[model samples]
Target: MNHTIIISKRISIYIIGLFLLSLGATFSILAGIGVSPVTSLPYALALTTPLSVGITTVLANFVFIILQAIILKEIRWKNFFIQLIISFLFGFFMDFTIWLTNGLPEATSLVLIIVYLAISLILVALALLLYFTANLPTMPYDSLTYVIANTWKIPFSKAKITSDMLNVVLSLVICLLFIQSFGAIGIGTFIAAYGIGKMVGVLLHKLQPSLKQWVYKNN
Candidate 1:
């Protein structure tokens, strides 16, 4: 496939992915659950530094990009731009959703909470679907762990678990220090995201049509 054409076709996917990411963040906020690691990092840094969340996220993403380039030399123009778009759009949409979802009661009843949780699950599934459908490149955090595992002869599953644990700890501490209301709901959100993402990947794989035509079209 022509890289340029693929980029054109996938740009909407990237945009919708960002929208889903932001939407997920909004749902988390509404559920009063903890935020994602990369998302939380910016908020944490913003608290201690003079930088805005947007700026901090850009810096963090760029650092990851550099690390990824060093560890895996597969960096290219298309992937680089995709990474940039992901980071920036995620930050921007997160803020937007936060503002939009604010002022609505968190959850008035158990049913409402369940409803919120269900929506969150769906949003996360959509995020993963769009993310992979972009067919551009994986995020640096994900790629970094994979590369480190392969290079150092560590178990990939173990590496991923360790990384996720670190993120959970960091997010918990930040939420605590900031006095954010992330409790069992936060854990639930994490589990739901994991489950939904896995399901999406499985389903997409099973349903993926032969790409000959799509690839040819892009070419």
Candidate 2:
């Protein structure tokens, strides 16, 4: 019963995290600035193609899972399938959030854009921390970081940095190729690239004790 309760709590937190994650990303795109580095490609693809950002995100994350298998030279069929399910859930969640946020007017003023970006970063950071605390199956994009680090025998930090840079570059290429302009790559990407980690670190530092009590221990 105890274990079941723990699992239930974790799943509940994970679902909340997933929804917030979608909300954050959607706001970033609609802020009229660049989306986060991790999301830039999908944002660009969504702009250039008929597919929605959510659909592009799902397809991109699916590729990440495949790339992980290729890097490991081995596949855990169960984890692969779990990640597949998560990818779709995340995609659908994003679609719903996009619909919900679509009613907001576009951010135009510099201050408003900054406000939007700030909200985006904060939600993403907090959502990721909640998701991690839940100890659930890892998201495929995040999973690729450790996969690359282990495969190359490099530190996780280096792997993450490299992965982010590659994502931004590819996003830039996609924008240039398809749209003939920088459609979804902007200053906001750089801000998110650095800000998200710092925000996450700050949040974890501030909330670790409270989270440990409520999330991982007796509430």
Please give each candidate's TM-score. 0.70, 0.96
**Cα deviation in Å at residue 105, candidate 1?**
3.4
lDDT of 2 at 140: 90
Report RMSD for candidate 2: 1.2
Per-residue alpha-carbon lDDT of candidate 1 for residues 38-58, written as tens digits (9 for 90 to 100)? 355555555556765556667
The CA-based lDDT of model 2 is what? 0.88
For model 2, which pairs clash? none
Which number leads on lDDT? 2
For candidate 2, the TM-score is 0.96
Q: Quick one: best TM-score, which candidate?
A: 2
Ten residues in sequence with the least summed lDDT for candidate 2: 210-219
Model 1 / residue 67 / CA error / Å: 5.4
Each model's lDDT: 0.64, 0.88
Displacement of the residue 170 alpha carbon in candidate 2, Å? 0.7
